[model samples]
Target: MSDYDSGDELLADINAESIVAGTKRDRSESAREVQLSKRPKVEDADFGSTGSNSNDEFVEHIAKTTLKENFGFDQFRHEQFSAIKSILRGENALVVFPTGAGKSLCYQIPAVAFEKIDAAKNGRPHLGSGITIVVSPLIALMKDQVDALLRRGIAAACIDSSKTYEQQQLTTAAIREGRLRLLYCAPERLNNEGFVESMKHVPGGIRLVAVDEAHCISEWGHSFRPDYLKVARFIQEIKAERVICLTATATPRVADDVARAFEIDKSNVFRTSPYRPNLRLLAESVSTKQDKFPKLFKFLREHPGSTLVYVTLQKQAEQLADDLKDEGFHVAAFHAGLKTELKAQIQDDFMASRIPIVVATIAFGMGIDKADIRNILHFDLSGTIEEYSQQIGRAGRDGKPGHCMFYICPEDFYLRENFARGDLPSRQSLRRLLEDLFHRDAVHTPEGDVIKLNQTTLGRTYDIRASPLAILLATLELRFGLIRAITPEYSSYQFEAMYNYYRVVKDDKSQEGKAIFSNAKKAQKWHHIDVNAAARSTGLLRADVIRKLNDYNDRGIILLKASGVENRYKILKELPSTPQEMDAITDKLYAEMETREEDALRRTQEVADLITGDACFALALAQHFGMGLPDGKTKCGHCTHCLTGARVVLPPRPAPSVDMVGIQKILDVCHVRDDPRFLARIAFGIKSPRVFELKLHTKKVLASLEDHDFSSLLREFTKACEAANFGAGTS
Candidate 1:
């Protein structure tokens, strides 16, 4: 959610415009420029006919020729050509191609082809030529895509928080000079008015908009994101010529939601068959938790290649990864709970093939285009069939035979059920949140009229996590327009000197500006200055500081850049008055919660049936994705069902025998929470709050069990906690 790009709306250096703009001409002079002509670059590419019309044919020919020339790809598969053809004709398309079926090429080819058009029309690869904007969900994905594009000589750039302020400025400067034919950015950037304005200002114009993982736009999508909902508005704002949305998995309902949100008609929604020839889908039954690990270890040892092991819980991913690593496998865990740097390192390692195995929660696999992955195993149950399909799609992407298997135990469904039902806020939580916001008004923005509230404060007051908070904010934004906008904080500011150092420092004429600008010349080479630090030291309002700098920027006094965390919405309406009005709002909120819970249940049941059913695995899975089985084909020859010639039966798990000594140790040493499970989780290092509500650095505890072996104690404590809360269930 934090990966949005509006932060790059300003210069990187205090005087970066001069530095960057100064160096732009020489690079152009030193490079060999592409030949420009009014005529299209490739006469061979101007095909008069194919499937649609002259332009489609021409784009198709151009795609084939370019594919061969640049990527040595003499062929286009699935709907790749059709997708490219549609984009070239300025048509909106929804492409649901499988993971390795060249889905990216549908947009990538057009971007490259358009680059040639830009080169032909503008004398270089930029200016007057339209830019293709790619809205990707992940920064890593953005970086990978841009890096690949650059390898092929495509003028690609990405803007995200991952880059330094200086680096972001360089990318923007490159875009300004027509160097960026394809600009990749995260979805959150659309919420930034400044970034939107910059896109509108691009001289080459925004010709095409490509959304990867477009399924996120669907309200009921498995991976639905509030930030994604902003993309439709962004596209509308940009007035992009052609919009293409791509995803590997989209159920009919999801596809419909995507179409409506993106305004893509059903006619242009292109779905390649979800069927893959080289992948053999399989499911194995593990009767008990004990049976699962030994079987997995055996599988890994026998068949070794790049593998992805999916687990339901973050703890499972970490524990399994640790276990596998101890067994001499180069494996690491990936989950949302880990710090960002660690996550990045694990992902990078997996991508570089430095780690042959990665045990991950659902967060790791999306947007990964590794071609040689040999296997994907579901160590835990997937929450939905769509997600399950997407996870397995990661394997066998290179058109080589690969294995896709899921280890199923009947008990898994209960955990998934808890997860789905738990995600939405409870009735009490909803009531509390609504009451808090209604009672507390907002502060006026820097503009002094638009009211705003910090989201972090609301989360703290309500005790809601960020994900649920985003969902709540989005719901309010849609129903009542109450949230106004959500954005990052304004962390830093960039400024250029309005007047020369001597004029400002040596004279009384600019004395008023001297406090903020007094040290401007000493830091002239650095593009960014510490806005918060400046405010702390000079007793200036951050808002006032930014406003003054923006004033300087507007009047050519100085160049200013202010980066916001996210853009929240303006509260267009007042809070409901009276108990009855509040009841009405809460009723609506409760209904939404019920709906999500029901949907979650339905999705979980669907996946469970797919896992436990006796039907042909491939047909059942494909049918869910809206693909029709051939009339004579009732079963896929390669699924776990067909290969094993039987339905998998879950082995009944035996409850672990509680270690009374371990439980007593926890009771003895750990601070007891109202809920004993919290104490157990904390002792086990399983992401629980610190004991006694004391700061971690305090090193104070109700009791100490430092002498205990963590592994034995954790195992026993976990089982005891589960036994205590078997009715409540753990996700």
Candidate 2:
């Protein structure tokens, strides 16, 4: 026989005998002993197993020769290279791998690869004009990613509201000149006319649009933004060469929305499993807010080293921080409303290890990459599972063991439910307001009938506040198919001087004429105030209102007669009667508003439900993008529900303690008392950078105390510190 045939036959015979001997071995004898006793020696011709070693060598060779030569990588973890290669091949990929799975590298490597390919073909010595546009939801996130890219010697920039006009101009100019390879911008910025124009000239015309936190685009996704709907049109207009959407958390529904927004083919999508075996998720429901502190104290005492505590409101965060500090813990608080510079300082302190715990709201944890956090605790239950997953994902990022505990209170559910209803107007109230406007001829009749009345005449005719009247009119014009409301313009002038001018001119006229002129001036001032009010209510720019007024003047519907005041104008239109169908129209409009309000509330609840459901977070996220989940196979084991039974259960615990020393420690770490919640968040280890930058290390200490009664622990710690003359007998 040939050599290969002989070798195969010999190996097969040896393996057969080994299997037979193993099966027939004594019950008490070791399996390893039996296998070794019957096994053939390595030098024997029958002993050959080279496939596994060959695969390893092949992988190693590729890592050293191919990867290192091209992307400067000596090794790759599971699924990293494959995902990167898939993206490079222009496939629509959805990577659901756990946090710290080298997700950024999946797209970053491909981005570099594309840059290389373009440079090679163009005979360029440097990286070419291929641009990757990343649409991030948060301004902070955009800044963070850009900063990271800059640190890596990559050209990146972000355009957001926080940037000054000069900064924006510079960024836009750089983009047009092809100096920027990656441009991070918020979805809202896409709606700005000036920003949109700047993107058109991006050097290579946007080779790829990578959407970070893509779940925000899907209405069905847990964190939906209304403005995200415009991303699709923006992408099409820019004609992005390729699209890659990325998110740390997403359900199937959210995934579909993302795909639709990018106009990507569903078949090209790629998703990794969301199951994180390294994380341990736990939830404890407390009976009351008063009971939470004690439980939290017990947890802190039980676990040592880095921990995060999450709370919803700023005041609660602050109060908790203060209480914990009084109990002798180093904590800080973080929130969005704080000044930018101060927030940065707090974050710096936390990262530098000055603060160990941070009490914070949802504002603190986006795009942060601190890997040493050992625990995450929620003082209050999160509104949705998507948020819960994201919060917990911050833990165990270093591939180390970490604990995530959530404290659930039933009352917190009501608070969350109320928050969900904050966005939309109440349908009943809206309907009533619409009805009043329609009846008063503020809106046009449904049958194309016009209600022609001067502002002064309308104000006199309805005895209602002029601002609310104008708001109703504008709302009807913009939101409903009502009579188009046109702004009338009168030339604005300094009121006192204009009043004198009118008197001088009317000196030759009759008493009746003088009276008419004086009354008109008064009405003009009131109208200006009303207009400002309208601008405030509708969230429209004063410039837009002024432009509308100019258009009205051009139409000759109203005369802008100068008055002696800065924006005061006299109305010239003759009073017109209300239309015949005004009442019917008003009733219809009001009913519509009521329905809209209800619809908004329902939508909010629906969002909450989608987040709390059993579907895979990644799959639900995919479905949001108009892409269906490949199959319902992936489950994120890191989620609270997945870890601690589908339904959350509370453990019986005693009353909570307010630790004065812990509260003081938190305050010391916070440094800024503007946002109290920020301090509370740090004490609980909620992952606020303010806490991290302060070098707070109370998470470990607090976790160790979690199993005990919080109040008792606080009292005991305080007493011990007092006895030991700690902080000059501060207790």
Index of the highest-lDDT prediction: 1
646-721 per-residue lDDT for model 2 (tens digits): 6544444344556656666544444543333333333433332333444554444323323333234434444544
Q: Per-residue lDDT for 1-731 in model 1, tens only?
A: 24334343333123322322433233231131221112233322434343345554555666788888877787988778777776766678999987767778888888778765444334534335657899898777787878988888778888775555446667777765666778887776665555765565554457789999998887678878877887887877655667899998898989998888777878789997777767888878765566788889988998899999999888999899999988898898888888878887887888899999999888788668788899998888888888888888888878898888788875675566545534554455567778866766555655233434556556555444566677777777765766545334565566655565346335534323544665343464434666556665677655445544554555565666555343345556777767888888889877876787688888877876787688888889888888865654888788878777787776554444445665675555554323443443344333212332333223333223322333455456556555656745653
TM-score for predicted model 1 compared with the true structure = 0.75
lDDT to native, each model: 0.68, 0.53
TM-scores vs. true structure, each candidate: 0.75, 0.56
> Model 2, which residues run further than 4 Å from truth?
1-83, 97-99, 123-128, 162-173, 428-731
The CA-based lDDT of model 2 is what? 0.53
Point out where model 1 deviates above 4 Å. 1-53, 115-127, 326-328, 336-354, 446-448, 491-513, 516-568, 629-632, 651-731
